[model samples]
Target: MIVTSAPRTKQILREVWRPLALLFVWDVVVTVVYFVLPFRAPSLPLTLFGSVLALFLGFRSNSAYQRWWEGRGLWGLMINASRNLARAARNFLPDGEAVDLKRTIVLRQIAYVHALRCQLRRQSPDQEVLRFLSRGEADFALARTNVANGIVDGTGRRIELARSKGWIDTIQQSSMERVLIDIANAQGGMERLKNTPLPVQYRLVPTLFTHIFCVLLPIGLVETLGVATPLGSTVAGLMFLAALAIGDDLVDPFANTVHDLPLNAMCRTIEIDLLQSIGDPAPDPAAPDKQGVLW
Candidate 1:
């Protein structure tokens, strides 16, 4: 995600420049037709349609933003769950075995965050998952369809083991187990967001309508603007085109785009907090680079 105050114009343009260029070309064509043939469409009728398009586009953009917001909120919940899970281990278990167990669980929780990040981004866990688990465990997780869920299951089993060994009381066991459940629920929520996108037909309607409106807008305005029709249409087209671009960027929050939720930074935040909780030195918090991207 973009964490910088000023996002790079070069990167921003790389995605939507094609449509802007097409809008410019369309404006030129409409202008040439107006000058060469003495033909014009009724501006009032198209202007009214533009108003409806604006309202429709606004609604669409809101829906996309809601999805993005929900996804981000789920990750926030996961971060808290990670901390709570570690804190439970620290508070409930005794010394010696408990110390080793707490450290193992906390480090594995960190690994879980990184593994989830990699899974959501459709990348291999590689070093992150292997860093916490033994070679055999890492191999087993990597071979699974969902590495994050697998890691969570492993943590749950460890808690059960600790309980069976009488390291932690049943009350403490249940408490930690509840936190794990919260973690699982949060993960499921995010996976749902990742898997269930807004319908393509719904996305296409506004987009196709907006493109058509942009292409035809100058034809309507040429009778009034005369020589300045191209300039006026260019400005109008840009506004509408930008609305579409914003909605498109927001609809898929986990697309590894600049507009996405900064999962990498979020995972790093959880890592720092969990490690510090376990008496380990914290790593540097993830920050934006010169380009202002956190990932």
Candidate 2:
């Protein structure tokens, strides 16, 4: 999602401001209480709490990163699968009445790529996906709840038809079909990542604990830091809260966030690869922007 050389300080501020604000508010409240009833700093073991929080944050970050990595890996597999399918189409099917059918199948694979991207992001595939399909095919895919799955089903059906008509023999059909199945597996893997979220504890527990530790941190430091407690607490709170925010963003990698996989660009890549194989005009691949962000 976020592909910049460095995320802007302003953007970082935007993400952690809420927690920072709470830290500031809580710090002020606690400061006033500190004056009323001077704090016994050593009474609260800040070191022990900090260690526990560190372990939790590490676990949470690792979990979210795994999900993000899995989604990216699935897309990598999809890209390879698309290329394989295109290669098979050009080689397996004999050039004749089946030419149109081969073209349709190859083109629809592009549609399937775009459709799956849209599906995972919970977006309408109207403009992007429809263009890849014929009027009738587009209309059918658009009407369906799971457009990507429908397109894949159509692909399998086309394979069957091509086999029955002897455009491709059983062996060729089976080989091409194997690539289709790999693509399907990649699709299913991404869909699972999109549908199944990180566990509830992963979502809630660390965040709650992080906030608790942040709020209590300044209180424990009141006696030692005195007037500097607020500043120290604010900095510490922002750091921990920012980490939590990043983990939260990464956990749902298909939500089309800045930190998400570059699905649009990746779909375009599949389009260019498959279309080029069929001697069709395809768009040039795009590069990351000047800041090396948002490719």
Top candidate by lDDT: 2
RMSD of each: 1.7, 1.8
- The lDDT of model 2 is 0.84
Q: Score residue 65 of candidate 1 by CA lDDT.
A: 95
Whole-model Cα lDDT per candidate?
0.84, 0.84
Model 1 stretches with alpha carbons more than 4 Å out: 7-12, 40-44
Candidate 1: residue 185 lDDT (0-100): 94
**Clashes by residue pair, model 2:** 1-258, 1-259, 1-260, 2-258, 2-259
Q: How well is each residue in 1-295 modelled by candidate 1, as lDDT tens digits?
A: 7776764677656876798788778878877877898655565578687998998799989999999999889998999999899888888877776688778889888988899888787887878888777787566567778888878888888899899999987888889989999999999988888888888866998999998898778778888887788788888887788788888888878888888989888998998999899888988988887777877
lDDT of 2 by residue, 1-295 (tens): 5666665788788888887998988887777788777555556887898888888888999988999999999999999999988888888888888899889889989999988888899988877776878778777667788888888888888999999998889999889889888988988898888889888888888989998899789888887777778888888888788888878878888888767888888988999989889998999886676646553
Clashing pairs in 1: none
Rate residue 205 of model 1 by lDDT: 87
| Winner by TM-score | 1
